[model samples]
Target: MRFVWRWRRNPLRRRSDVVEAWAGVAAVVLMLVLGTAAGWAVGSFAHGALREAVRQQQQHRHLVSAEVVRSVTGTPAEPDHESTTGREGYGRFLARWQDPDGVEHTGLVALHQAPGPADRFPLWTDDEGRIAGRPMDRATAVVHAVLAGAAAAAGAAGLVEGVRRVVVWRLVHRRYAQWDREWQQAGHTWGRADAGS
Candidate 1:
């Protein structure tokens, strides 16, 4: 009468039904356990890797004061999209800054606002004094790690669900085929009144 009948001793319960029920239970349990384990493991690994990268960036990247050499007049057709500063009133200039090694380097830098004569702004550079983006912050690294962990958990759960669906699909087909065979056998003696006697 109820779906739970599959788990109890009943004449109407077929072997395939019992197997399907157990399989469904197993799938739910596995999805939860595997998803959680995968999420935690991937999250831990990603956090450790990102933290190490942050440390390396902090060690190798230096922020130094750069003087604006000359302003590039007129907005170029292509602006520096990667500029951390907002693009409105954006100013492009040839800037010079000294590296940690006391070597001077000049490059085109984008600023949020036009600079006055002898104006200076902070710029990030590598050891060789080439312009570089700001180093990754700890908060950003943590957020990325959390996102990766969530993705991994979802992927694990999806994989488990897919496998369960495939197994259940096969079980259902087998059950249907078994029923078809029984029906065909019964059809052979359908008109015989003494068939069951």
Candidate 2:
């Protein structure tokens, strides 16, 4: 209790201490803001690159006639097949085809349409292999990246703020200690005068 009173009376415990503490807090806040922006930029660039790669692969794809070896139902159905077959489920078809080099390849194809047990279907394949469809557009990929980046930034900001508050509290406590010591020395000198009287 006496220590609290002495600290309150000390002139060295100035308002500037509060200002400096707030300044440190502001610096940390600024770092979090900048980090978030940088993270978003990086994520956006990566997503755009991925989408472009998909688009290029789709553009180079070639169409070929394939024989359906078998047909199987898929879970959660294909959207295109839903309207035609009046069934809301996905379908898978096993197909075999000869490439331009006359090499036979067998793979599974997911169709939006229901096929009979042994129906023929047009298959599309790129130089490397078959793909579901064209790559996603850049705008869609960017939106997803931005959202993910922002979420990460928000989490980081929370951690930084917590650490900054603890540091500031410790600094404030140190300043209070110094002020208390100065006041106690002054009080001791005054007490000696009262004793002599």
Candidate 3:
């Protein structure tokens, strides 16, 4: 407590103290901005890259086809009807079928839109006849791009703010130096006058 009081009363420590405080504030703000940008960039990049890699691996690959034995909405409604919509309606599809090698496989595909009950979407399987990956829609790609760009912008803004604060500190320090010199000169002059008298 005594140390804190002494520091608060110390005139020589005042300018340096203000500069240190402002520097700490600038550092915190910069960290927040950079951290947010980095996180967003990583998330966007991972999503797009993984999706594309999976799609490429599945391209030109063939799978045994089968008819939809049953179609039902994802909700709590009972399975009662067949959907006639195009590929756009195929939000999520579950297919149960057998491969050419007499092996059975169940595949799940997530589509941008809902697919019809009878719509024939391509299924890609590995050597083991396991469903590997599916193609991603254009809308999902766009979202990833947007998120990455936003993160870059946030990082840039943080750097700019940090630099601005540093410049402000330099200016404040220069002014404080000039004021200190002036005050010391005035005190010396007063002392000389008192001694002469």
Q: What tens-digit string does per-residue lDDT give for candidate 3 at 10-129?
A: 656656555555665666676677666665677678667856854765563345564343454563422322232234445556666666576887645544544567666555555566
Looking at model 3, report the run of 10 residues with the lowest lDDT sum. 77-86
Give the per-residue lDDT digits (tens) of candidate 2, residues 84-143.
234346467777876656678887667676777667777766565443444456566777
Error of 2 at 67 (Å): 4.6
RMSD of each: 3.3, 8.5, 12.0
TM-score of each: 0.82, 0.50, 0.39
Model 3 residue 62 lDDT score:
48
Report the C-alpha lDDT of model 1 over 34-138, residue by residue, as the tens digit: 999999999999999999999998999999999999987664534442354345677778788999989888877888878975799999888888877899999
Clashing residue pairs for model 2: 77-89, 77-90, 78-90, 81-112
Better of 1 and 2 by lDDT: 1
Model 2 error, position 133 (Å): 5.9
Off by over 4 Å in 2: 1-33, 60-67, 72-92, 97-104, 110-114, 120-124, 131-134, 148-152, 169-197
**lDDT (C-alpha, whole model) for all candidates:** 0.86, 0.64, 0.59
* Model 3 bad stretches (over 4 Å): 1-102, 105-128, 131-135, 190-197
Q: Which ranking of candidates, highest TM-score first?
A: 1, 2, 3
TM-score of 1: 0.82
Residue 5, candidate 1: Cα error in Å is 3.9
List of clashing residue pairs for candidate 3 = 89-113, 89-114, 89-115, 90-113, 90-114, 90-115, 91-113, 91-114
lDDT score for residue 116 of model 2: 73
